[model samples]
Target: MELVIGIDIGGTKTKIGLVDKEGKCLEDTFFRTKEYPDIDDYLDKVVATIEELKDKFNYANILGCGIGAPNASSKNGTIENASNLLWKGTVPIIKKLNERMPMPMRIMNDASVAALGEMLFGNAKGMSDFIVITLGTGFGSGIVANGKLIDGFDGFAGELGHIDMTLGDGRITGLGVKGGLEAYVSATGLKRTIMYMQSKYLDESRFRSIAYNDLHGEDITKAAEEGDPIALKAFDYTAKILGLALANFTAFTQPEAFFLLGGLVNSGKWILDPLHTYFEEHLLEVYKGKVKLLSSGMEGKTAAISGAASLIWESHTDEY
Candidate 1:
């Protein structure tokens, strides 16, 4: 069976996997991304891990490697100014990896690869246009239009998270941006919204029992599940903001659907219902009720691995 290596680089951890063309992950493992402050050291460890996997699998049909990372650029094959990562400045990841392994390798933003995976192996299999929104620690987005990923001029176009909403009282994002969609709709944003609701409702809020530092998105989710008014309100507020943003996004791309991925999406109806409601309410008449709001069919390591592998598959087939 033809195989490829998929590497997903995140803020805290990096997951590496051997994936087949069928989207099956044969073997997978991870390492702490922050542990290796030196890029070369990290690359060395990655190379060693790949070699270990190759030996264990005893497979020689490996096609190439595809990496998905924050601030990754397909045009440059580099990770540039990634705020969440420990690396400083632009790192030529493809070049460094090729020096050791000497095979075809490609890289792009994590969300973009996820979108590609969705198109090839998940919910978007037959769709020609769609958007994937990753609601992780931070918000990330990938846009596919007319069966093509929109990389824009700098290969960094689908930054829907940074779309300014002009929400004057919005929470600040890790990038220190205020009023960005990520500041109000991501996991961190959920926590912030919960805290705000706790402050607003005070004694009447169950969240009052939870300390500020101890509060988490999971806590709010649990609370919402248990019918906590404050928690539900937090979800409502977050969805309203997100819906508005997505509605505006629709005006631009008019995709057939929008797929939600990541932890916050686990809240299910607590977020989706309100999001759908407000999205339609805010959408332009021509676009209303046409765009579908869907959950990602891919999840966990499978999604990441499949996405990375799909990158290589697409590259090999000259699909992008």
Candidate 2:
């Protein structure tokens, strides 16, 4: 059967899947990324996995391959400075992968792929202009404008995480700005808030049993749902900053909606309600109620792969 391959290169592990044109994943596999010692080793292992898939399936109708990696530049097909990865500099991933597989290959940031996936087959389906925000180990934002992903002059546009939004005398520094939005809204950002709250609010019983260091965005959300005061405060803090940022973006880009993806968004109303409240509070009257913050309706990994698959499918169609 005709198929396409999609790969999501994450900080912890990598996911590979075979999918058809309609976004249905036919087969899927996951592997520990430690198989490789360096970027080159990782590429070798990836190529080897592709070869194995090809041999096992013997599928002649394979269309192309798509990859989503953090800090990836679609224009150059390189992973440039992923804060979560061990790599130090730019890695010419697409060139290396193409040399081995020799098929139509495309690469993009994981968040961008997720946004595209939603636009193509998920929550943002039928919408041409929107943004997808992935709140995980870090913050990732993707923009789709005029019906296509905006890969700026050098493929470095839509970097919403780096936007400045922090306020205070002793806030964390980002790049050069003090208290950037990322300093308050990302996984690390939220953790810092939780730590502060724990120090101020957690009593003996609460402090001794909880694992604050190991806590993730999901845990914070769950705690908030259970009426944990500390967790609710953290989400409230994050929501204020995030809502402010969204208000600012809405003024500039005027997208139809913003899709919230990743673990943090799963907190549901604990985060969303506050986010909406602040967003409305900060937004101008004209733009108020126009932009929405919605959950991603797409399958996470599958949506990314499907996005990668579109890299080839859409391009081929355009050519024909």
Candidate 3:
């Protein structure tokens, strides 16, 4: 019964869990990330938590530790330039944690970890190539090409959000392009689309009553599920762009499948229909019937933690 500590570090909270090689979590803890202002204090708390859990579980050997943080580098074991974290620069996370646990450590960006998790234990198990796109605050993707996670030369590969898409002279945001996939597919981006429609197409329409910022992807989904014209159109608009982007990716990598995850994807049919429709519509002729776009079998917080756990398994197995 070999076990490892897995941590999923988000902007607001960090989820720590003890997972066996079988992908089952034996124990878990949640803590507010803001509780500690300094990085050292943060690491200390994490170390103490692992110690407490190891002692209580009576595990003799903690095989390894794995962490999933936004913008983490798997090859370097460092977190670099995270948009949502308090850190301003590269931080050596592996070194700090190794001091406490004295075990092998692995780290990856949250999205990459999620993709890896899927490959190891979920939908992508036994598959060699696929992409996992998390539709949340932003669109994050982890790419696996040819049975291995593509780390690129600098270890910062698979930034699918920045893929360029035609915007037709829309208002520009800080992402610096006229329109990127992230501009239309992420949670924030979807809200922006809602605002655009309110001011453009829905000025005197009933949809205007819904507050722009307060409106969520789920709200739009519910309305769509009930056959609201406005919500249906919104899904169509967003899904079309996502489909096109996915088609472009398919033409290049030709992955066996594309795994969709995160809260926004919970829209179920409201999203999947249009997404699949457009993806197939725009796919290269040869890839028409080859690619599969599937919803993530794992959902919510567990998806990311599962990914972190897979990192531990991969790191341990690689040594042999």
Candidate 4:
């Protein structure tokens, strides 16, 4: 059997998956990324896991290895200053991996890989043009046009989170940018929206009583699920920003649909219901009633690992 190794590198956990061409994960195991503050230590553990998986699944011929990570440069197979990671500077991931395993290696931003996964195995399958917007700790996007993922000249494209909304609302992103989409539409943004509303509305709400540091994402989700007015209003506000931004994004690629993924998406109808209404309202006449906003067909680490592995199958789509 022919298989490929897939790795999904995140801030907290790294998942190593052995997958077939059909995107089935025959086996998967993970190590804590945070435990290895030094890049070399991290890579050592990752490589060991890969070898263990290879030994356990000895019958399969592993073709290549693909990886998805933050602040990754697919063009260079290096990670450049990923804020979530403890290590500094650009790490030559491919070189290190090759020194150990010695196979074809490819890497890209995690969100971009998720988009690739969607194209190969999820709802976006057979669709040429679509966008995958992940609403997680921060906003991340993967744009597909003309049946190919867009990895620009330097492999730093598809950064939709940095789109400036020019709200002038004083909400600054971790990137130190003001009015960026991620500052208004991500999970971080949602929490900020709740806090802002808590101050402005003077409404009797659980969020108001809870300290900012003590609050949890799940708490807010539960409140919204139960129809808490403050949480609902916050969702409405956040969705409007995202909906408008998504409408504008259509002008660039004219994608047939926008597939949403990540933790914030778990809020379900609390966010999606309002998002659809606003997205339709703001879309240009030429594009109205055409672009669909839907949840991602594939979810969690499995899809992500498959997405990373799918890079090996593509002839040129975001190839390193």
Which candidate leads the pack in TM-score? Answer: 4
- Pull out the clashing pairs in model 2: 166-179
Q: Model 3: per-residue lDDT, tens digit, 46-101?
A: 88877777886784567888898988888888989787888778889888888766
Off by over 4 Å in 3: 167-178, 203-206, 315-320
Clashes of each: 0, 1, 0, 0
Q: Which candidate do you rate higher for lDDT, 1 or 3?
A: 1
Tens digit of per-residue lDDT, candidate 1, span 236-278: 9999999998899998989999999998898888999898899
Top lDDT model? 1
* lDDT of candidate 4 over 234-283, digit per residue (tens): 99999999999999999899999999998898888888899999999999
C-alpha lDDT (0 to 100) for residue 234 of candidate 1: 94
Ranking by TM-score: 4, 1, 3, 2
lDDT of 4 at 241: 91
Better of 3 and 4 by lDDT: 4
Lowest summed lDDT window (length 10), candidate 2? 166-175
TM-score of each: 0.95, 0.90, 0.93, 0.96
Residues 1-320, model 2: lDDT tens digits: 77778898887888787777667676777778766659778887787776676676784588889888888899998999776677768989889888877888888888888877777667887787899898876778889888888888988887788776534433563444566667777777887888777777754333236676776677776677677778878889889989999999888778899988876776778888999999999998999888988888877656666766666666654321
Better candidate number, 3 or 4, judged by TM-score: 4
Candidate 1 regions off by >4 Å? 167-169, 317-320
